[model samples]
Target chain A: MPAKELIRLSGLTKTYGQGDAAFQALKGIDLSINVGEFVAVMGHSGSGKSTLMNILGCLDTPTSGVYAYENIEVQKLETNQRSMLRRHALGFIFQGFNLLARTSALENVELPLLYRGLTRGKRHEMAEKALRSVGLPDKLRNKPSELSGGQQQRVAIARAIVTNPITLFADEPTGNLDSSTTHEVMTLLTQLNREKGITILMVTHEDDVASYADRVVCLSDGNILSDTLNNRKNNK
Target chain B: MTWNAFLIALREIRRNLTRAFLTVLGIIIGVASVITMVTLGDGTTKALQQQISSLGSNMLMIRPGMGFGPRSASAGIPNFTMDDVEAIREQIDNISAVAPVSSSQMGTIYMQEARSSSITGTTLEYFSINNWTLAEGRYFSSSEATSGAAVGVIGDTVRKELFNGEDPIGKKIRVGSSVIEVIGLLKAKGQVGMGDQDDCIMVPINTVQRRITGYTSMHNIGTICVSAVEGTDSDKLVADISSLMRQRRNLQPNQDNNFNVFDTRQIADTLSSSTKTMTTLLAAVAGVSLLVGGIGIMNIMLVSVTERTREIGIRLSIGALAREVLLQFLVEAITLSCIGGIVGILLALVICLGLSQLIDIPFAFNIQINMISFIFSATIGVLFGYAPARRASRLDPIDALRHE
Candidate 1:
């Protein structure tokens, strides 16, 4: 299949507050991501990389911009419609590995499907499959507190991808892990991106973390400073 | 979706057992106390009515005064005569029986026992009018009553006090310096609010008028006991008796009644209504506590929203609708209060049973009241839970995610 543009943003600007108190988080920015691409967004603390990901994931809206996701105008969508879009088409992961405390790993993976009104049997089956794919089949009934940090993130990944969403937005998913666990999580992400062709957009500050992606975009002061292709051992 | 929300709510409640209990404590106390108050009130009302009915459901009492107070006794009011009793029995259409009654406190002695008791003087009609029954022997015959014979029937208390459980029938006992032969034993009527009903002696009216007191006057009757036929309206009977007494007393057109007629049913109704009012007032006060309980739930829900901000963010990011989030919290609050309500109802049931037994009143399980209390507590949940649930749903995912 030919490469197709999945997301397009032109002159996107987000302003918080008004008058003298107004703070511009995202300045006039133009960016486009293609289908099946693994893109890494890099920035410092206040570079607004997280804000850009939040917008792309449909968790927020831009103040003044044209945001098109799969030919749908994201900025024009209602809050509920944006939620539906996120429900059916997008998935998210956070650095904290935010799974409900005291809930089993399998139930954590079944949260989104619960919202989708799936039956208990179907949800249990899918959740079990997802946990197995994440290599925590034996940890299905273990609470997040009982799991190691890497295992917890794997459970979060299983939760994010259990619905088979078209795109996955991961914000510093390995920020809380050591070097070995970070490699494990990065390898899992690569496998999901290559084998399943699920588009991935990740945010990171470390070059080693960014190297796993097929392309890299660096933002400074909410504007793209550089966009470059990354040569890796195996590029899809 | 609602069922899922409910299950999530149950899980959350189970997770924080102590906090949930503390949060719903107000509701628990509220519902329990309300039910207890209403149930006990109904029980008391029923007990009172039963006691009154034991006095004779269709019985009426005619006194020689306008009101039953100290003023009437001090005014030297004219007493009713046997003629008035006879006229009422013959004139009234719904009358089942009527008897002229005269009573006095008299000292009675039998062998080694001595007791001060009320000596009631009436005829055979009094037994049927007041629904008294004989436990042993027989009442005085018409020849014995007409000849003013010294014969009487002793109540159960008198029987026990004087005879000491021995058969007192056909025995002689001195009553007010006059020796009378006991012809019957009256059945025991348990002690009630008014007084002990089984601590008196019954003799013939002629026997008391002619021999015991020896003060024979034309107006010797102190009261008239009149019982209406079954299914007769008490108000109409009272009206009929009032007019008959007025005409017999020769009162002018503008004159108020110089006598009083009392209906046992009216007393029962008044007592029942007063207790019902008291029950309603107490339940309303308890309902205020339920309101306070709702406010408590709101306070805890607000804290829960703050404490679980990150969890809410995770859910929001995972495509949970804002409304779905709202429903989860609302269901949680409702579930907490409903659980409290259920436990409260069970607690109230136990309390009512124990108290009824302790206080010697009837135990009445009122389903309407229990259901009302449960539904009210749930309503309280919705009324107070809306604000905090809305706050949770309206939270921005970005800010919520950043919360610790």
Candidate 2:
């Protein structure tokens, strides 16, 4: 990769269970992700794609590997240090949106900023900016139950990016949305990547969802089967 | 992590209004009951002490006996004569007033109609020594006391019973076949430690000795009322009386005194100390209720921790520090207890005020007890709240998130 790399993993391995019953989730996988790269990881069930995403997001440590983020060795970080890294450098979007119900969208976005030690006024201001950037400025006062599926996902996205983290991790971000809303959300993500140069690493099972990314890496049986670049015209 | 989190936690408590109220009810009842009982006990003790002190601190009582020794039903002790009273007055240094009292169970008293009452015979100084005041007529003269005259004073209850609301002063009341004219009606003095003071008729000592009981000398001198001189040594006065009685009876140094000399002030001190000990015991029993309330808080908090596992996970995953989680839950528990304590204090005040009005004893509102109850309830919150808060904070985010 010519561009500056943001994540590099070498000899990454994850094993579960004991002795003879041990099953490896990720076996000796090596990968590099460059800055501002829009990558999608596609896999069948039990293919270790989720494990890779977890290691990439600093949520899990590889049992035997050297995982580096922007030249910093992530595997050696303490538990609190790993959490701090996740707080300062990573944003996450889950398939279920995972937004706390009965909470306003603004408050939902303010959650991450609250942990950053920002004052009330500054936290609210940053939350409003993030929600506005996600094109939901008018929905700040609305709760998760009051918003549509696509609007709720946008609030989740705003919450993810409120801390201005270095990389965005979306695990099946549009899996629960309708076909039309899926296209709408994908266009929004693509625009965020092109306009703001924010790195996007997404995991999805659907080929159509993976096609929205600039590059795709496919996995089967805990091994990367293919890595390809797309030449399609920009959809947005 | 920030004050906003605390504000949010407070708002959350406000949202669950019913749960919050129910959660604090235990602490409320606990604190209020403690305060009310303590206040009532203190008031009763204060009233008792005040009543005892009002009975004349300088007065001493000399009852017949060898200092309250074992009683002998077969043979009675020698009666105190008029000469014994004179000898004590002559020998004692701080003798202010001396009166010899004799009592008999002459059942019925009659003014116009007949009623039941006890009759007592005493000298003139009995009026001042026992805090008696005449309401309608004059007290008996010293001449009447010496010449064995039939003059008498009637108490308020006796007057009411025999006179039937009519004036009893200067009226002749027939007592046990002897007619004695009432010289004075005593002012309304309420009951003291013994019983109702207004249930007897007073006659001259010589008259009761000569006519009613028909004995040359008084046998049972119920009590010898002695008042100490102002600014003189009361202990020296008691010692002088003891020495003079020893000389009169020709007793050796190893022999016990033949009479009991009790200072009313000492009795007052003894009564107050006993009241204090009783009040403290009652307060300690009431304090157990507060402990039970604390245990209730702990039980409820532990259940809340178990119920909100997923919520804790969500907060933790969203970047909430373990300490922040710990503090949030702890504050919630404390808020519940503090609200309960405040309401309990208010309730206890109202109850104490009502009880004071209904009872004879005064109900004193003590601010120190109120503060202590509040602090105690808050301490209960902190102590009981710790385990649940720690459990919530120490939960594994991944495991908690996956909890169904």
Candidate 3:
């Protein structure tokens, strides 16, 4: 089956400030990703990979460009409308497990659903289900500070997938974890992709982490340097 | 204003429990001080007005002085006499009753137990004009006043001093060289002006002129207590009385009259207005503290916003709008100040009632002032809460997220 296009970014250019001090973060970036595809964007510091992710995630807008997602104009939507889209159709995981401190894991997972105007009962039920799927059913009442690094990442993963968005944007999702816990988190992401068919886009500098994605896109100096499909599969 | 925002606001406040409590201290003091001053001032005004009204309504005190207020009684003011009282009684159109009151410290009372008390000599109409009621027995008859009989009505304090709560009616109490029979007890009037209304002895002006004082011609009366007919224009009565005094005193039209006619209502009004001004001034000063309280809340809230920058970023990244973050802090601020307001109201109530009892004045709740204080407190919350909330909302999500 021909893969359906989910996001299209064309001639996207972003510049900070103006005149002498202007810094170009993203220059003429054009890329397309399809439904159910796991793409890992590889870049070093100052490579503008995060800028592309920000534009795609609706966290910020490009200075001059066109960005369309699922036939809807991403650049023209109002701030509230973009917030609504993010609430309904996007999810994010960060390098820093940005869980609200002193809050329980269940409550952390339920935070995003609160903006959707769901009933408290529904929110609790769904949060419980998401935590169980992330293998954190017993850790629902524990706080992030009380959990190990791997368990905390699992809680963060539960929070990311609680809304069931079409695409999951994970920016260095396993960056803060040890090597063994990083494998555990990557295995969870692979299981979610294979089992639920949810699309995933991650940004990382580690080649081992990038190898988990089906395709690797490398960025350097504010532009994409290469895009290639991965051949090796280590589901075991 | 949404339910989630409200819940979030409470969570933030709970997150910094001790800080939140401390931040509201300024507001608490502000509201309490302002409301307490106003409430107590209102009570004092009521108490003062009541005391003035007890002196009798629609009555004027015509003293032999140029000025009318407390500062008017200078030592050199010429005295009015019985003749002037008669002239005013005869000339005024709405004049109901007039009594010539003459006071002298020269006479002292002696009984089984003796104490020095001022003696006042006046006509029987003085009882009616001053609204004095007889606690027991009866005032002296007009014949007793006319014939200069040695009969007297003892005030409450005189009875307490000389009689010690024993019935003194029909008993003899000596005044100077004369042994006067106590015929009546004047009802207690708490206090009025410079002297206790219940501390003086009342006898016939004629008797005082002949016996207690050497002024035998009845030519000098200290003040004339004039009562107008009920519902008469007090201003007109005062004008008529002033004109009659002027004519009797032989003053020309251009001269400031020697005698001052003062209204009880006017005195009460002046006293009450000054108290009101004082209350307003106190409230304004306390209102500055309210502002300071608001500023304190603002300062703390700004720090909290900066401290929670990453949390704000997380909420923004997960579908929260700028206004949602704005609502969080605004609601938090309003909660802080509203708590302060309610607590202030409670504290003011306790302190006001306590002080009123301590100082022996009536305690009254001024609902309007309390409500205004509360509303002002809420307004302070909004006013001071805005800047910090705006700063929080205007933060760039990406930059905030990247903040360590």
Candidate 4:
């Protein structure tokens, strides 16, 4: 079956401050993401890739743009409505891991499902399955502080996928991980994309990290520099 | 959702156990002191009522005064006479007993024991009216009271001082240079609000007039004691006695009566109400501290919100609504204060029990006040916790996640 369009952004612009102090982070950007696609967004410092990620994740709104997610006018949604949309349809992974310190890994993974009002038993079951998928089944009771960087990131991945979201936004998911741990996390993401058909939009600075994606979009000075498909060996 | 917030709040408080305890200290002290004050006040009022009731049952004291207090002394007013007491005894309805009393402080001696004691002279009805019961010996015969016989009844204190616990019946004790035979020894009536009830001796009014004061007149009676039958409205009784006294004294209708008839029950009520007023005042003063305690909680909660900005960001970013975050913080504050209130109530219980025993008052536990205090403390939590929780909920997820 042909892939379905998941998200579209047209003429998107984000400005901070005013007049002389104003800085435009995204200037007239147009992009389309398809379901089940693994796309990497690459940019240098001051290139506004992170800004685009923020707007796409619904953590922010663009100054003037049309942002449609599954044909829903997300830009016109209220803050609470956007929250509900993010709750049910989107998941996020951060470079810092962002696991709550001193909290058990299982509980951290179960955080999103709490807002979804799932029963405790059901939430526990789903969170455990997600942890097992990320290869941290035995680390369910370990706190973030007690876990290594790679293990913590795995816990973050488990949390992001625990809700079975339609789209996953990973902002430098492997930035803080070692090369070996990076390969392990990238392989896990590849399996989830190719097998589970979960669409992913990732931002990265490293070329090798971008190599995991099926397509690469390079940004420079708040505008797209290149959008190209990548051909990689089926190493997995 | 509320339950989840409650659980989260409990975990947060547990994580910072020491800080939470310190934050609630003010509330604890506030609740404990208010409860203690109100409890002790109730105990004192009860003790006072008990003591006053011991004075007499349904009794009235007709004193030769306009009213009680220093300004109302009957020094310029005429004293009640035996004829007035006689008229009440014969004429009034619902009346049980009547006695005309005259008292003088005099030196009494029995063998080597010498003491200055108050000597009251009244009829046999005085003992019944004042609820006095003799421990031993017999009261005087009617002839002894009528013919001015030199006989006396000594109270417990007088017996202890003059006779040294020895049976003094039929023994002679000199009162103001007159030797009087002790016919009866009164039971120990303990103490009341006025003074020691067992400190005076009672003889016939005629004996006091003829022997002690050397007056030999029937008009020397200082006061009259009257007791009504049970179930008689005391207000009506007072009115009856006043009217009788006014008629016997030949006072004009327009004139203010020269004497006062005091119902002991009314005195008890007045005294009890005053005690209640004092308790309310003390509780109110203690209530001020509860408000201060609420402010303390607010201050710490504000600090807590600032410290947990990043944690709030994480929750917000994970699809938690603003009100959910607000509920979490609000529940935490209310839980903290309610815990403080419970601790305070328990502390007050212990303190009231110990202090009541120390101060010789009844220990009164008022559940109503305790409940009011608890609800008030919880309200304080809500009142003070609102601003901080609202601030937490209104936080921007992106900015909050960026918070260090």
Q: Chain A: TM-score in each candidate?
A: 0.97, 0.95, 0.97, 0.98
Docking class of 3: medium
Q: Pick the candidate with the highest lDDT.
A: 1
B1-404: candidate 4 lDDT, tens digit per residue: 89888877787778678768876786787778788888998898888877777788788888876787875775668777777887889999998898888988899999999989999989988888888887899887899998879999999999888888688999999999798999899888777777888988899888898888898667777778889999999889899888988888788989898888988888778888898898888888777876676677666666666557777778877788888887887887788888889999999999999999999999999998898877777677666666655765576577677765
Candidate 4 is scored at a TM of: 0.74
Taken over the whole model, the C-alpha lDDT of each candidate is 0.87, 0.80, 0.84, 0.86
> Could you tell which candidate, 1 or 3, scores higher by lDDT?
1
**Interface RMSD after interface superposition, model 1:** 1.3
Question: Model 3: how far is B210 from its true place, Å?
Answer: 5.3
Per-residue lDDT for A84-134 in model 1, tens only?
888899988889888898889988899999989999999999999989998
Cand. 2 TM to true fold: 0.72
Model 1: lDDT of residue B85: 88
iRMSD per prediction, in order: 1.3, 2.4, 1.6, 1.4
Residue A136 in candidate 2 has what lDDT?
98
Clashing pairs in 3: none
Model 2 agreement with the true structure over A1-236: per-residue lDDT tens digits: 46998998898988867799988988888888899989999999789887788777765567898999999999898766777787788888877787876678998899878778788899999999999998998999998999999999999899988887779998889989999999888888887788888899999998888888999999887788989996645743
DockQ comparison, 1 vs 4, better candidate: 1
Deviation in Å, model 4, residue A213 alpha carbon: 4.0
